[model samples]
Target: MSFLLRLTSRLTGRQVGTDRFGNVYFESRRLQPIYNRPRRWAIYARGGREPTVVPPEWHAWLHHTVAEPLPEQKRYPWQQEHRPNLTGTPESYRPAGHDYVGGTRRVTGGDYEAWTPGA
Candidate 1:
């Protein structure tokens, strides 16, 4: 965390809860003059600050989408565990022919040609 964020967090934040991943959630103890509502925020448990690190339940609460945070036991058996988004990371999904994976796409035999404007 930067000096400013650390300072701001200390000055205005109150711990609301922590998620299973160790991400700590907070809300402003009092509304500040700059905003219409008290602010809510989170500090990432992992070194990276990926938003995906937050579970679905916490995501809803953080955005005020739900009135209350999800209870630990409320999750259904069919539901999968939460995982952070990994679009650009090494762990991200890559199709079979992706360049980064050292795979080459099969070339199709020439069956058509591009049309020239005046041809």
Candidate 2:
């Protein structure tokens, strides 16, 4: 995959920018086809769900809101860092900083205990 990207990049003369999640972004050197929006220069990236994994700096660049890619510029001090959205995975969106969720709630809806009449 890297080889193909490197080859394409070489042919186009655009450098690859590696984001925080190992995703790569590139700008077109030839402006071959702009079918998506037709007016803006198309920016591309190799990514999966939740583009936040790309980090704030790269996110700006990926959307063409910024001109330069990461490693060249930096995140602001007040800007919070990136953490992949983990809503479904075992290791995702947990209360603690670390540790995976085991998916077992201690109390179930039907298992409530009734109070005794005279305790």
Candidate 3:
């Protein structure tokens, strides 16, 4: 699959850059026809939705802000590579102010607990 992707990219030949996440990007090899709309598409790890899914460093690369791929030998003190969110996974973050386990809301004095029919 990777081989196929590389071959297609070679044919298109606009590959200006790649990101830390290995997402390769390219501009149009030929001048786009006046009527042609810009392409807004990518193959993501879980699924592609919006640009926010891509973090700041990678966002810059995708937009051509930096000429080189991430992790250039000369490290910038502030520059950090992209890291995709894992909100839905067990490894997701639960900060000090956040809730890990939910408790039910009860206005009245009632034993509010999770529903289990047999229990």
Off by over 4 Å in 3: 35-55, 60-81, 94-119
> What does candidate 3 score on TM?
0.44
Global lDDT for candidate 3? 0.54
Error of 3 at 22 (Å): 3.3
Candidate 3 local lDDT, 1-119, one digit each (tens): 25675577667656665555555555556644773533322333334454556656556665656654455455578966455666777778766544564544435666777799988
Looking at model 1, the pairs that clash are 52-84
- lDDT per prediction? 0.82, 0.55, 0.54
Candidate 2: segments with Cα more than 4 A from true spot: 19-23, 32-50, 70-80, 94-119
Please write out the lDDT profile of model 2 over residues 1-119, one tens digit for every residue. Answer: 44665576556655556654566566665554644421222223442245545676676666767566546356689967667676776665565333455555455588678999988
| TM-scores for candidates 1 onward, in order | 0.76, 0.47, 0.44
Q: Which candidate is the best by TM-score?
A: 1
Minimum summed lDDT over a 10-residue window in model 2 is located at: 35-44
